[model samples]
Target: MAGEPQPSGAPTKGGWITFPFLIATMAGLTIAAGGWTNNIIVYLINEFNIKRIDAAQIANIVNGCTALFPILGAILADSFFGSFTIISVSSLISLAGILLINLTAILDTLKPAPCENGLTVCMAPSKTQLAILYTSLALSSMGLAGTRFTLATMGADQFDNPKHQGVFFNWHFFTMYAGTLVSVVGIVYVEDNVGWGLGYGLCVAANLIGLAIFVVGKRYYRLMKPQSSPFTGLACVIVAAFRKRKVFLSSKSEDYWQETHAGGTKFVKTTPTNSFKFLNHAAIITHGDTTSDGFIKKPWNLCTLQQVEDFKTLIRIFPLWSTGILLCTPLAMQMSLVVLQALAMDRHLGPTFQISAGTMMVFVMLSTSISLAIIDRFLLPTFEKLTGTSPTPLQRIGVGHALNILSMAISAIVESKRLATARSHNLHGNTVVPMSVFWMVPQLVVVGVGEAFHFPGNVSLYYQEFPKSLKSTAAAMVAMFIGIAFYLGTAIVDFLRKTTGWLPNGINDGRMDNVYWVLTVIALINFGYYLICSWLYEYQNVEKNELSSSSPCPC
Candidate 1:
């Protein structure tokens, strides 16, 4: 709380950078990032001559790396530099990365020559070519990571009212998904039909424009000053608690670390809770913990009461977070494999019109975008009108779990049918199946709806439940979960390829139905685990009166 900056204008967040400008900036960046990433699998396969399964694995790895970088951005924004500086720097970095990718796409020497045949006999990129390709990928990934989630936090920073913040979140997600939908559908089509050079060039232009918009509006932003992270305090609590493990905790509030008016600072004092009794030792005033003047001379030897409580909050919600990992892994798996499935399936809507394989996931993006708007406008209001309360985060996430399981089951059935048609034509020998690509839509739509329920719900839980000091990083937590799921999906794919014939390079030749079935089982089990975690966990921030009309007020 030290050295907090004064607000610039009225409640509308400093009155300089308005909501529309920030939203526009976010949309542009989202479009730029999505355009390049959406069809990365196809690019790797066609342009680099990577195997189908290998391309999918690499895609997942790229997804994971890009998603994971946001945590570091959040940490820096909250702990060192503010969002404006970090965002500006990140935007430039991202612009540079996109330019590099565009260069590779434009210069033939940077890539391998076209395979006279197909990938079966195509010349792979040389070590030098690979180094340039990887460098471009890494730079682009880093650029994407720096801005994606940080933009969310920055957008929320523009509003004063909690209600306005909530509205911003909905619109933020809506814009992000909508922009991605356009990229996956429109730009990906360009990459698929027109050319990679032109497609990547569009992304570079988009990134440049986005960064320019953000920098122009920089002075108007309401900047939140960075303070030392409360996680440091939490760590101090753990260290002090262990050091004084044998020390007994007292019931007196005075025994804890709360600032008594001594012309220095102000801090609220509260009695320790009964739930986490052992951690109370950190707050217990003892011989060497405090100075003679009553201040904590050695910080590592003591902690504030809030620090202990904050640590407890994390422990309570981690199980819920853990369960959602598997929830997301199935979707990640579906996303990568579905592209490969589309590549090998009949994509013609008519003799004249054919769908690009990369554009198939646009259905998922569209479904999520529509569902977010509907859930925000109609579903939540209708539920509150019926039940006299909004749906709890757990309730929303629970619905996501059920829908995810169903999506996996649906995916399994569709794949099974696709395989059956492939076998009927004796199409295992390098032949594309006759099954319609439209068959992939149902499962994608279901999973998108699930994401609609779960993604925001999980983010809300983290922000509500996390300690004040950790609020900045709370948004990044969801991004980190997504990254982990992508990595886990990669591992699952690799394991299946190495162990069994269920995941051959060609899904038509392998038993893809079994892979989906396995994903379904994993989802079901993780859903059960989520239920248990939700049942046992308590909310850290929910008001007592609000709890009455919905779930039990356990906390």
Candidate 2:
């Protein structure tokens, strides 16, 4: 008989165990996802013969789906199946999606006929074609969502050291950004120059390779079982608190029921914090709330003080998270618009060498990859040595906000200059402007730098502070922000086109600079809001003692 599968451990046994396999898996999956998505708008336009803005909207929908599906995956991981199973299933699903897309790319019947070079009217893709295309995207989006950040939590589970966990985060994102670089620069180039069929075929290969590696390393992974839904506990906390609203507040910490020790045993707990005092009522024992041994008689009637405090932590963190949603809206719009700009501007490096517009995102990915390595290895250490303290997540995120504000300003300025050049050349209505695509790099690079600080900061913060049971959800919350931002960006673009002349059918005729300016003002206001939230918020967990930090009450 085959050897029995390895059992789950405390994950403290292995010192930085399974790092290599996990990193490889991450890198491969990144390439798979990035390669497929990097040139999605170009694929839709070229193959389906769709209009520019319409193609962007579809791409945004894909991006949104990419962001949204992870939450479902995470919830299932935390409340039912574990991460490894989810990752395995998702990888297979994603592989299937890539294969479907590749099929579409290879077969002429799956897409509309290629438009003639000078013709304006082109055939739209058939409903059957659109159906297959959407099915492929949906499968791929679900696959990407389930595997990416859930793997982050899985990787972190292998490390006992808080600092080691933090270090893992850097490499995790570095792999992510680095893989994106390879896809956009290398694979997207193939899509543009060689062929889409081969490009998506490579994506399928990458996904399969990643899945195989992860399976081979399965025995080495740290595994955890599903517990009760974190959501139900949070809901109970709210309901119990409201039901006991009229109960007299307790003066003694000992009076509250604690999860760690409930019966005759001494335990220590900080009396619930003064902020959100109304929530403290959740722990107040009303009639029939508890049994003789101080155990909860009814789950909905009473919650442990820990459950009450967990709800408070989420509520407190909401503002900070909301700022992150707004933070990416401008960037998301700018990102989509930049590709269009690249299409209109000069992309030639010399007489022979020309670049793909889709590949332009490589600059952002490159900047993020390099900057993350520098920050994680050099800058953070140097700052700590000089200042005797490492930068807090809030501080790092604030820096990101500042950088974002600056990037928006730069984008507005660059777009203004591009517009001036376009106007001088009398460019209008689908004509290319005589400007260099290089003009767009500064803004893209700055946004990348900003992400280096904020993206990891946000992930690190959520991972550290979330209730242990909700770890999967914690990592996936950042995706929620991104998904919301992309959808919001699409809405904003639609509003601009309908309400104002700023975003016309052809950006050559539209005042794209004015849209950038509007985004700049919005970013500045959001940054101010971020500053206020960051100032008021205190760190929930800064220590290596996970249990003590997460539990306001411990025995």
Candidate 3:
């Protein structure tokens, strides 16, 4: 039923044949994206002579923009060009942006001179240089927004069977993690040791190759045409209800206007539920609301029962969704803060080898990749065997909340120890702390493990609970919330800088430990809030029994 070709302009029949192209493209694009973004703070500090705190702020904003753009890209795809066109054009845009970045790395004139030996002060870039850099970053972020999750949606669209879709999603995530791992470790190493120009040039090449691969697979893709935006349908329900505010509520199934399937069967055979009864007005049939054949004549004044139900579903899930914003904010802050910490600490792996500050996230990626395998192969099966039921997505999310709180506490403890060591040695204002960067590994690994549980759980919960028409948007929702969290992180950082001595250009002179402690407290409060929301939440589309039996994989 899922794989069959639809009526003219809908997705056509496509299957596993399209997997290699999409997967390969995802891998290349991810690697290319990481090549630039992973080491951005270091780049700004070293090449552009920006202060460490300012560079971290810029990195947060770039990360926020990159995450937020997907919602817009999804809207455009669902409303106008469709996924194939969007992905293709976006890849080209990314390639162009990367080329510009590479040029900046190659041409010394495009950047301010590097700070001279043993000097804290450095020259700032000119306005023209800043403009070039900003334009490149904007284009790259926009390109990334267009392709990232849309590719997943398009790949899933190719398969008709749920099992096949599950396998595709697993592979999709695997490829993505692998790409990021390689780029963060490998590409960052190249940028730090070899040359930034060569590092960004590789990114440009990867983007070109990935784009070519995707285009070559055009014939194999089951391209879905742009349809009316699901967002529009949801808005119509609200508007229609407001206009019919004085109308009496009714429980009768026959009172509401229902659309028919192709075979003349009612699209939504059941009457509206009592929950959010105000929205039911949108479906109440009124004189002249529809034509003789039951088609809507006044789109804003009338909606099908299905549209009303979809709006209600989103409303029901709003509280649970809001909790994720706060839950993610601490993690976003930790991500950037850890980078600054890594920059100021010892990163040696051996006598001749040194780890790049940006590559410190490799611990998180490595832990997540390994933990996902362990969960899928060991923990999940063991839990099901012991309890005679699989763990629910909410349960997984709850576990993640606990782990995140613990991770923040660990980070605070480690930062305090690092600060004590710095003070004892009188290392204030020094570029590198006397402490080892590996001291940060435990917290990084803990948070990565937390992500292993929560991210997939959130994805699964959203995809399963969202209305059928909004499945693509469901995939992008995670990105949207994470984007909001990054913006919040930026605000939190700015607020702290203005009000406290927790962050400075040189963290060695500031109370970095205090920042981690504050984050720990915030995470603790957020976890409690998550517990309350999860407890109050009830699954609408998925039964508890069904949820307990479903695979923990995102699909």
Candidate 4:
């Protein structure tokens, strides 16, 4: 019974848990590298004397590259190399880039000081050094793109079986968030205090560590090699369409032939057994069928034009879901602009306490990590029992969106108060707010709660909903959503500065309270949109169906 007819290519028990952890570790490292850069922008400006605009531009370039290349990586993974190989190659590439960056930094440090005071004079990097920096950033971005999609899809592969699948995804998402928590807390701090080289180097190390873990668990991994291209399916759909036309014509001819053969006898209108059989297999349409015209017609098959039309018909019936892009926008800000904004706030912990913006992220990360662990270990099971329906990943995603709305609301209010306090004290000229640095705590805590809700839920949701052939594409879309949000946020900031006469004396002028208020308002608007989207979202329970029903393998 234990070995009773199982789903196609389902992994054994051991592979399920290990796969998620491996992916989580890689994700954690990527976020850490990004996070370190975010928190240390101010330090980079102050210590290196790099212009703020130049620093911001560099960061934007890195983000843009990171977001853009994932699509290509996903394509490669889905069409050519398998996820494991992609992950392996990407890890090595990222490691090499990080090492080069470290070497550059060390070289900079070793250069002779120009001042008699013996203090190291900051100098702009030479063209060669700058080119190296850009190259390293690009390489890291490429590597991340190559691996991100595969890991998520591979993690989902662990629970291909139906029985243990119920709580399987819950654990999967929990591990991912747990990993993020570690990156935000441990890795972000390391980057902020230690310097950029060390920060990126640590990220590389984390990637290597994750790769090692995956290597050791090779036997247990439920790996899926890339399948045939979507274009192949599209070609099949075209063939099927032509065959469908032929079938219709043939059916008409058969009806006419039967009428003539009756020869004055009344023809009994009997339904064909084959037609009834086809009806019985309607639920199995996603698999496909051999058509009368020598073409295989899969359910929602993209193989022929008619099949493509059938697929469209199926899509039309799907529930109207929230715009995932809008839902993801505010959540994406937490990693990018939010970090930069937090650093702008006075982060001094007073004489007795010392905390930088990057260090403060530890609290948020720890809180989120704890929350994720609890949710997986306890909350998910309890909710399942109470609701009588295991929460679909989309439902979990909705919860995340709701949390983000609340987090943004809190951020707006707290920031408003901070701004008011600063303005009343005539401290507008001060870059750092005079209020206790602890004033930002509420915002940070709320962000933590929001993170716990959104990140894992969305990842799991995308993995579950997307077809196996498009899993990498789906994952890349998630990354793209974040990138779009970041770009939009940056654009909005720029527009506000230009139109409202905001940043009156430019970014370094330090009177940025108005900008904060504007961003807070923007956050509120995003929260409202997210709420609407969440309410409209439809949930899909991929785990309930037998794996044989939906598994990618033909066998």
Select the stronger candidate by lDDT from 1 and 4: 1
lDDT of 2 by residue, 68-125 (tens): 6788887887778888899999999999999999999999989999999878688989
Candidate 1 C-alpha lDDT tens digits along 1-555: 233455587443443346776788888888999998889998988888877899999889888888778998888877789777888888888888878888888999988887675435778899998898888888888888888778777777777766676667666766777788888888888988899999999998888888888887766777788778766788898999998899988878877786446664354557889887888888888887766666778899888787888888888788888986788898888889898998989999889788888898888777776787688678988998999988887898899899999999999999899889988888873468988999989998988788778876777677677777787687678878888999999999999999999877666789988999999999999998998989988787865212111111000
TM-score of each: 0.92, 0.90, 0.95, 0.68
Best by TM-score: 3
Ranking by lDDT: 3, 2, 1, 4
lDDT of 4 by residue, 1-555 (tens): 011233789555444457556655555555545443444455445444554544554555566556656776666666677666777788677667656655655566522222233233456655665677667667766776666555655565566554555344444444444555566566666666666567666766776676667677666666665765564554454454444442422222122111112223223443222322222122212223535543334533323222243334224223322344455444444444444445556666556544556555556665676666667668877987899876665566566666656666666566567667666666643255555657666666766666566655555555565544444454465666666655665565566557775444223243344554554565556556655654665433336422111111000
Candidate 3 per-residue C-alpha lDDT over 95-125 given as tens digits, one digit per residue, 9 for 90 to 100: 8888899999999999998899788677999
lDDT of predicted model 2: 0.81
- Which candidate, 1 or 2, has the higher TM-score? 1
Stronger candidate by lDDT (1 vs 3): 3
Clashes of each: 0, 0, 0, 11
What is the lDDT, from 0 to 100, of the residue 419 in candidate 4?
Answer: 60
| Number of the top-ranking candidate, with lDDT as the measure | 3
Q: Could you give the C-alpha RMSD of every candidate to the true structure, in order shown? A: 3.9, 5.0, 2.9, 9.1
Candidate 4 structure, TM-score to reference: 0.68
Model 2 misplaced regions, further than 4 Å = 1-17, 161-168, 261-270, 467-472, 542-555
